[model samples]
Target: MKTATKINTRLVVFAKAPQAGKAKTRLIPALGAAGAATLARHMLGRTLDIALSAAVGPVELCMSPTPDDAAWLGIAIDSAVQLSDQGQGDLGQRMACAVQRVTQLEPVLLIGTDCPGLTPALLQQAAEQLGAHDVVMLPASDGGYVLLGLKSPCPEIFSAMPWSTAAVAEISLQRMKALGLRVWVGPMQHDIDEPADLDHLPPELMNL
Candidate 1:
């Protein structure tokens, strides 16, 4: 049997507690509030499982609203991973915080729970790419990115910029270029967010 090879790169997953009305709310129109929440729960669990199974490095679950908040009650996390709160900020701020902190210790891969295509192999590939490139970014079909791998913090890329818009990935790319950083960006992948994105969900999650 092949054994798992541990890499030095750290993997950080930013997620929100699967609370109804808050989690995966964009899908509520198609799946209903309770159903959307259920899907969110499944996504978070599967994302964590994939991250751990990758064995690329130590895994961290960075929670929004913090784990102590009532929103996280009854959620069971794997003991193999570390937990931290994505303290105060908008999306860009929260992500930058985690990236800056972890990259300070070691190379890191920053991801979220919304992408079904974030398989173990993809993560390992990203980590490998980081060996030669200063950064690796996997862009989302929605124009944002699903994963970002970095050996060090790039505050300019995350500060005072528009987020959630179609320009996110492009702007970040430009920032990296201006900084003279070597970057490797993968082809676009689907991020299951809005109701229209429901079509992109994996076969197993379709029933949900």
Candidate 2:
């Protein structure tokens, strides 16, 4: 009997330290500094849980403000999971760097901690699609992307683009087309960012 070969697909979670005033600042007006940070912490935990449950492959937590920050002490991550700094630069530079580093080991699916709708099945679906597509994007309802997976490093897709605007997904697809990279897009999902987005939060996190 022959054993089936496993694909080397990594789930890279891009997260910020859930510190008051530093995390989820956009929602602070509605939830206060502490409350917003609490929500950030909850979202990060949920994201991590979903990634682990997906069991697609190894998981990495790419932290902003570094992994040594005290804000990480509140969450319990499996010691087996890899931890690394998000490195210097804007969102584009940071993601490009992270993707470059991880793609050396295996293809990577990069995601943020903001989307509560991200599930294990969705992560698995993205990973599975990467086996055929050059890139896979899970578009967000807010015009950004909730997830991005790449079979290989393509820095052009991440460079010189506006980060927080509605044009993000549109511009990204344009760049991918310019590079002649094939893209697979998943269903749209929502992220918890502004006060209006609070209604989408899970019931347990709605107390805020």
lDDT of each: 0.89, 0.89
Cα lDDT tens digits for candidate 1, 122-187: 998888888778889999988899999888888888898888888999999999999999888876
TM-score of each candidate structure, all chains considered together = 0.94, 0.94
Candidate 1: 10-residue stretch with minimal lDDT: 1-10
Supply the global lDDT for candidate 1: 0.89
Clashing pairs in 2: none
Which pairs in model 1 have colliding backbones? Answer: none
Once fitted onto the true fold, the runs of candidate 2 whose alpha carbons sit more than 4 angstroms away are: 1-6
